[model samples]
Target: MATQTLALTRLAASAWGCSVRRAKELYTKVIRSVLAYGASAWHKVADTKKGPALSLTTVQNSCLRTVTGAYKATPQCYLETEAAVPPLDLYLSARAASFEIPTETTGKLQLLRGACIKAAEIINRERSARRRRQRRPQGATSETPVTLWPSDAQLASAKQWLGGQTVEKALKEKWEQRWFHAVTPTRGRRELAAESPPDCGACHRYDDMLKHEASVLMQACTGRIGLRSFLFTCRVPDVPTPLCNCGEGRETAEHLILYCKDFKESREHLATQLAPNSLRTRRDLAALTTKKDTARLIVKWLLRTGRLPLYKRAMEVGGPPEHVNLFRP
Candidate 1:
C-alpha cells in the first residue's frame, strides 16, 4: 500500500505540470518512455518472492494513468502557491521484470487517465467562477471603466508655475533673444512662413509691422493706451488727410504713416530742430510712440518708430509749405 500510494503521488506531480487541455497530447510522448523502461523494473520487483503479485504490464498501465491524469487536471501554472509535492518511496522503488499483462488493459488505462484529467479540470474552473463573484469590490458598477487621476503633486506643480510672477517677463525676454525679426522658413524653400498671419490695418498696408509692434506694447500697458495713440506717436494720423499733389481724395492711415507728402516735410523740419545730442543717437527718441502723443508729437514719435519713407519722399519733392502738422516749432 505504501508503494502504491507513492506511485500515485509521482503520477500526480507529472500531471500537474501540464494543462488539462493538453494532457493527452503530452501523455502519448511520456507514456512511450515509461513503458520502455518502467515495465522491466516493475517486472523484476513483482517476480520477487516477497513482492506483490501484480503483472508487469498492469503496473505500467496504472502508473501511466495516474501520472498523466494528475498533471493534466491541475496544470503547474495554477498550482505554484499550493505546497504539495510527490512521494519519494514509490518513485524510488524497483519494479518486477518477470510479470506480464494483457495489451487490452494498457489501452484502457490511457483512456481512463484522459477522462479523469478532464473531470479535475471542470472542478477547478467551477471553483474559480465562484471565487470571482465573491471577491468583487463594492460600489464598482459593471458599466464604469477603470480610470486613473493625476496625483496631488502634479496639480500642485501646475498651480505653482501659473502663479509665478516672472512668466510674462520671461516670455518677452525669450522672444527678444531670437535672430530674425519675423520671417520663418517654409517647406522645401527658404521662404517667409507667417509666424503671424498678415492683417489688414487701418492704414490699408499689406505689411503692418508697426501696428503689430504697437499692439504688443499696448497689451503690456493694460489698456491704458490704444492703437490710435500708438499711430499718432508714429505720426501716421488719427484722422485721414487728402493727398498733397492731387485733390483726388482723402489720404488713408498708410498715407499719413508712410505715404503722406506733408507728413514727411513736418518730420524733416522736426529732425533739424532737434538738439545736437538728440540728433546723433538712436536712444534719444526711443520711448515716444504713436500712443505717446498723436496730434502734437507725431514727428518725435515717428523718429522713434523708424518710419522714414514718407520723410525721404517729402525731402526729394517739396511738399506744401502750410502742411506742417508733424513738427512743432
Candidate 2:
C-alpha cells in the first residue's frame, strides 16, 4: 500500500526545491501516517508478533532507508529507533489505547470497553498458559502477580503510556548516524577513482540528499549519465561512435568540460573564476568538486551546458527510482 508513497516522496523532494528535510517531513505526514492509520486495531495480531513480523516492517524499513539514504546493510534496529519510526506492535497498541471509544452511538463505549477487556483476557490467558509450560530455574526469583485486564485508568491514558511523543534528541542522534555514514572513510584515491565520484562536494545537511539533488549528483558524480560513450557502451541503436559533437574527441565529461570547443567560452570564464589551472586534468576536475569556488565553477558549467537539468528531466520523465522522494507543502 505504501509502496507508491516512496515514489511520491521523491517527486515531493524536487517540488519542495530539493530539500531533504522536506522529503522526510513528507514521508512522516503522507507515507508514514498512512501506514499507521488504524494501526491499533491489528497491532497485537500475528503479523506484528515476535520472530515473524510481516512485510509491514520490511516495507517500513525500505522507506526509512529511502529517507536517510543509508546503505542497504544498515541494521534494522537502527532503521527503526534512529529513524524516528515506532515499532508496529507498540504503536498499534498505544494508538488503540489512545483513543476513547466513540460514545455518540448507542452502547459504543461499552462495546469498545468490552473489546479491550476481551483482548486483555486473551493476552492474560496466553501468557499464563505459556508460563505454566516453561520449566523454572533452580533459584529463580518469584514472579509478580499478573493482572488479567487493564484498569479504567490504563484505558484512559493509553496515549501517554504508549509514548508517541517525538524525541528531538533521538532524531539528532539519527542524523548524526547519517552524517557518520556519509563521511566514513574509503580505501583511498584508486577506489575513489574506480567509482564515479563521491559527493566530495560540500556536504548536505542530510547524508544523501532529497530526490532531485540525489539523482543529479548520483549520476554526475558517478559518471553514468546518458552521454555518447554511455550510449555506445549500451549499444543503443543509432548511436554514433562515442564521439564529441565538437569533433575533437569522444564526448566524456572531462573532455567536454576541459577540452571541447563548444563550452570553451563558458569554461574560460569559469577557469578565470577558479584558481590558476586547478581544473587541468580529469582527476582535477572531479576532485575539485571538494573546493567551494571550484565546485561553484563546475556547477556554472553544468548549468550553462544544460547537463544537470537534462539529467533531472530524465529522472522525472523516466519515473522516479525505488527510493526517490518529492516534498509537499
Tally clashes: model 2: 12
lDDT of 1 by residue, 169-230 (tens): 32233232221232334321211111212211211210122222222222211211223433
RMSD in Å for candidate 2, one decimal?
A: 12.5
- Compare the candidates by TM-score and give the number of the best one: 2
- Which tens-of-lDDT digit does each residue in 1-329 have in candidate 2? 65565575454432133344555566668776776786544444221334323556676667655654443444454444333455444444444554433241355666666787788777778876776789666577755544443244544444343344433333334334444454334522211123222222223423333344433332344344456765686687977688888889876666677898988888877878776757677677766754435554564456457644444564455344436533321
Q: Which candidate is the best by lDDT?
A: 2
lDDT value, residue 218 of candidate 1: 22
Error of 2 at 329 (Å): 13
Per-candidate TM equals 0.20, 0.41
Superposed model 2: Cα runs more than 4 Å off: 1-10, 13-17, 24-215, 247-249, 291-293, 306-329
